[model samples]
Target: MLKAILIDDEHDCVELMVRELARNCPQVQVVGRTTSSEEGFRLIQVLQPDLVFLDIEMPRMNGFQLLEKLDTLPFSLIFVTAYNEFAVKAFRFSALDYLLKPIDVVDLQEAVRKAERQHRIDGRQLELLKTQLHSHHLAEKIAVPYQQGIIFLPVNEVIYAESDSNYTKLHATQNRQYLLTRTLREVQEVLEERGFLRVHRQYIINLEHIQKLVKGEGVYLQLSNGVSIPVARQQKDRLLQRFGWL
Candidate 1:
């Protein structure tokens, strides 16, 4: 059984989480819960839980401040927040798992399963997350899970992404390539806002790296890296509009 602790400033939120955990996750044993970040910090030290469900907003200290006060985090962390869309994007870039307020059962179960598999995010990832959140600006680095660990890659360095069956291959600067476990669609969601355009069902190219666009029998995009990518008939109009050529 995974020993767990719940920390939220709202008493109702804590109670609801306790009830939900009891119903959906039988493997998790809630060792302690608190409505104060300071008290929660003490509870964590005393209980020494395997997992912690932490709320991001709290009076006096808040979640991030409380985390900074700690010397080392030995337990897995799952952030519970009611932050805006930009904050949610920040969480994604940092490769951290967050549960939105009024948690969904499916999401909760999935997060717990992941915690069971990988105990916690590495220290570097957590530091990256803190830097982005504290600065109130989305960082240019994106954390991608690699092997059994994670890699923080600069978004600007990525040249293009290609679909490879169930996985997506990221082609970057310096002739480097990474095969991600996520699908092309999943990768597109993260890269599209960062100047990447999905020109074909099989390819996403960085706008900054476009060398030329050949519109002939078959439309193809010439990238700065010297790789030619085909453009889907349906996506050509959108791609053209992106550059105001339409």
Candidate 2:
């Protein structure tokens, strides 16, 4: 059984979560529960649980602050919060699991299963997550599902992304290409804000890698990697808008 702890500010939340864990996730055994962040911190040091269902908001210390206090973390944290838009965005980029309050049992179970699969948590990973959450910076890496495992690549190395039917192919700086099961649309949702522009329905090019733009009846983009992709006739305006040319 996975030893776990719950740390929330609300008494009702603590009660509900305990019930949920008992009813839904039998594999997780609740070793401790506390409504105080300070007490929660102390419990973690004493019990040293394998999993922690952490609440993001507390009276004295928020979730990030609590994490900063723990110098050594051996457990996986599944954050529970109401709506932390900014933090959630960072969490998605960092590939961290979080449950939104009014938490669904399905999502809770999924997080538990994921935690069980990844048995140990690295302290540095927690630090990275804290950095991503606290700073106005892009996530350090992105995870791409490969054959039987996931490949974590630095976000800066991405040169462009190509649509491979249903799968998206990630073209990186080192002449590496990874075919991801995720659709181009899904990849765009993650990469679009990070200086990537969808020049065509089939291609999303990295803005930083544009070598030159040749104007014609239709515009064409030459990438740093020596490949040119056509800008779709309809998306031409949106593409040009990136350079303030339209």
Candidate 3:
């Protein structure tokens, strides 16, 4: 059984999570629970849990602050919060698991299962998450799951993204490409605010890397890397509007 701890400011929330874990996740044994971040930090050190269900909005010390106090993180972390879109994107970029408020049992079980498989986080991944959250700006780098580990890639290095069935292929600077397990739509949602535009159903191109836009024969864009991406008819106007051409 995976020993787990629950940390949240709301006593009621903690209680509910405990019950849910007990009912749904028999593999996870609740070793400790705390309503205070400070207390939670102590519980983690004392209990030495295998997993931690952390709430972001807590008094005295929020989740990130509590994490900073730790010398090392040896447990799997699954954030539980009512965080906004920016925070969600941060979790995605860090390749971390998060359960949104009004928690879904299905997602909780999935998170637990993932934790059971790989129950520890990379320190750099945590730092990446902290940097993005603390900066309150678009992320500079993204942790992409590659092979058996994760690769931290600069956001600006991404020149374009191609749809590959359920997966997304990322083309970056230095003539490199990576296959991400996430779908094209998921990739778009995270990269759109970071200067990427879905010009076609199969592609999301970085606006900054567009070298030329050919008008003839079903309009297409040539990127700095010399890859020509076709622009969907529906997205043509939006793409043109981005360059003040419409």
Candidate 4:
């Protein structure tokens, strides 16, 4: 069974989830529950639970504040927030689990299922999430979760990404290529803000890695790694404009 704890200022929210966990989730054992952030911090040190269901909105110290206070995070976090805005923020923080207020039994079970699968939380991952949340700088690296472990690739080292049937192939410097289980569309969506541009349906290029642009009936991009990827005719204009070639 997974040892778990709940930290939320909402009395009813904690009570409802506690009851639901007892009724439906036999795999999880709730070790402690707290309505105060400071008390929860002490409980975490004492219990050292496998998982923590943390509420985002609280007086004095919110969820982010409590997370910042910790020197090291050993447990997986499942963020609970009442609004959709915080949900996006949670995702940006690479939160593995997120539950909205008036949590559904199914969502709660799903969150616990993920928690059970994780053996331990990576401290580097927590640090990266914290940096992304607090800093103005673009995220320097993006970690891709794979079957055995995670692949932490420096964003700048990535030359481009190509579609590989259901998977996306990430090509980086030194001729390294990783076939990720996630789709190219998903990868594009995440890194689109960070200089990744989809120049064709099959390819998204790292603007910083472009060596030369070849023009013909269509266009082709030659990456620093010497891979020439074809650019779709429709995207040519957008690409040129983005590169200030137009």
Question: Which number leads on lDDT?
Answer: 3
Q: Which wins on lDDT, candidate 1 or candidate 3?
A: 3
Candidate 2 segments whose C-alpha is farther than 4 A from its true place: 135-154, 161-170, 176-187, 198-204, 211-223, 226-237, 243-246
How well is each residue in 3-104 modelled by candidate 1, as lDDT tens digits? 999999999999999999999999899999999999999988889888999998899988887888878888888999888777777777777778898899
Runs of candidate 4 exceeding 4 Å displacement: 12-29, 64-72, 82-114, 146-152, 163-169, 177-183, 214-219, 244-246
Name the regions of candidate 1 deviating beyond 4 angstroms: 162-169, 179-186, 214-217, 224-227, 244-246
Count of residue pairs whose backbone atoms collide, per candidate: 0, 0, 0, 0
TM-score, per-candidate, Cα-based: 0.86, 0.72, 0.86, 0.71
lDDT of 3 by residue, 125-180 (tens): 87888888888875689888766667889888999999999789999999998988
TM-score of 4: 0.71
RMSD in angstroms between candidate 3 and the native structure over all alpha carbons: 2.5
Model 2, 1-246: lDDT tens digits are: 999999999989889999999999999999999999999999999999999989877998987788889877678789898866666656655556789888899989988987886655555455556776668666768766455445678877888999999789999986999887557886787788888888898999888898888888878899999988898888877866778664
Q: lDDT order of candidates, best first? A: 3, 1, 2, 4
Any idea what lDDT model 2 has?
A: 0.81
Q: Of 3 and 4, which scores higher on TM-score?
A: 3
Give the C-alpha lDDT of model 4.
0.79
Count of backbone collisions within predicted model 2: 0
Cα lDDT tens digits for candidate 4, 1-246: 888889999999989989999998999899999999998999889999889999877999988788778888878788787765433442543534578788888879877887776655665665666576556444678765555656677888898999999788888888888776556886777768788899999999999998898887767889898889998888878886887783
Per-residue lDDT for 92 in model 3? 82
